[model samples]
Target: MSIDRVVEQIRTSVFSYKKLADRLAERPSERVRAMIYLKEIAAEYNLGTIEKFKNLLSFTLVKLYDDIDFSLPTGLDLERIVKENNVVFVPNHQSHADYLILSYVLFDRFKFIPLIAGGINLNIFPIGDLFRKSGCFFIRRSFNNNILYKLTLEAYISHLLSSGHAIEFFYEGGRSRSGRLLPPKYGMFQILIETHSQLDPAVRRPLLFIPISIVHEIVPEQGALTRELEGL
Candidate 1:
């Protein structure tokens, strides 16, 4: 049997097991709860086990090209970073593939590194659900001016960082419309530092800032940026 077929069989078996477990018990155990969560996420995202298998397969394809020379380092020291301190993996955003690239590198090569991603906008189709289930939380991009909401968001981020979660975010708030490095936005970083300061010294883990430099021979979005720049 092919690898894809094997993955499909595993997913189907798991789903069947979850259904049986749910029917047999009044209240599910933690393991069952976790399975239910995954099932819900997959269903909401319109992702069957087959779709997720495809995403992983896509990740594999990207990995094949991960080592292509770009005059900069591609491999991240995620294990070392996670072992020693709390980290925010800040990388320059260039392609839509950035998240998958980083995720594959960290998870496949270095083991499980949990990352918190900025949630996709609600208007986006099925993919948004996929991203959310894939470990992203929503943030209101336009609510930067709302003080209460901003503080709440910061607090949540602080809580995540303080708990030693390996977080990843683009320093450039959004994808650069222009294919150039934009200035770093410190909103997330500031929250992390402020939260760190409030924690007792003995309990606080030092926050490590690891800058990921992604160099591509060609910017995938160069055409869009060029058109905008030329006022075309």
Candidate 2:
């Protein structure tokens, strides 16, 4: 289904609930509170016009910091991988800048702009709207036992994959506060596996799980993370 149709279906079928067991998995009061967030996230999937914004972002980044230098694993052929299949890009979590850096790499190298999995927390404020327009779709950090919420997420992801859109999500789950590699969290991967199982075995094998590595010479979030750890 198209994004508009999918978003509407989710809004009406999921958030229109009146109780915990109902559509949105919340009481009326809770649903009322989440209305804004829910809508913001739904609108987050709107990703038609992005090149203009992406180019602008690249320009701003160049002025603020040094150019980003990253690399794909040796012997891993991105062109060959995507020739006959969709890609589920799993990159390491390091800094907030990873989004733009990877986006630039994907566009410049492969001429692809993927649907990224972003945190719902970042789905706030003026910047959030910009990021959404730049092709981000929000994902809450934890599902918190809400099956309908999980279903909403799965449905969104499934829609993108089935539609042949390349996807990018941090296999490390969140930014590494310690500047160390966090063990990969496979929850999202598991969901994709389940989605893959529903596909024909031949097609399933062709879907590439591309593992990308990002190394930053300098990280903007470094100072803030240190301060946060110091509890000051």
Instruction: Show where candidate 1 strays beyond 4 Å.
Output: 1-77, 119-123, 200-202, 227-232
- Candidate 1 per-residue C-alpha lDDT over 66-90 given as tens digits, one digit per residue, 9 for 90 to 100: 5543223467555665877877778
Candidate 2: clashing pairs of residues = none
Q: Give the range where candidate 2 is weakest over 10 consecutive residues by summed lDDT.
A: 12-21
Q: Compose the digit string of candidate 2's lDDT tens values, residues 1-232.
A: 3434545666653432233225544344555534444454553444344677667877888886666666666897777676567688888988987878788777767877778888889977887877776778887888859665665565555555555678888999999845678999888898776665554354444567878777766566778888988997
TM-score of 2: 0.76
Query: lDDT at 131 for candidate 1?
Result: 62
Full-model lDDT for every candidate: 0.57, 0.68
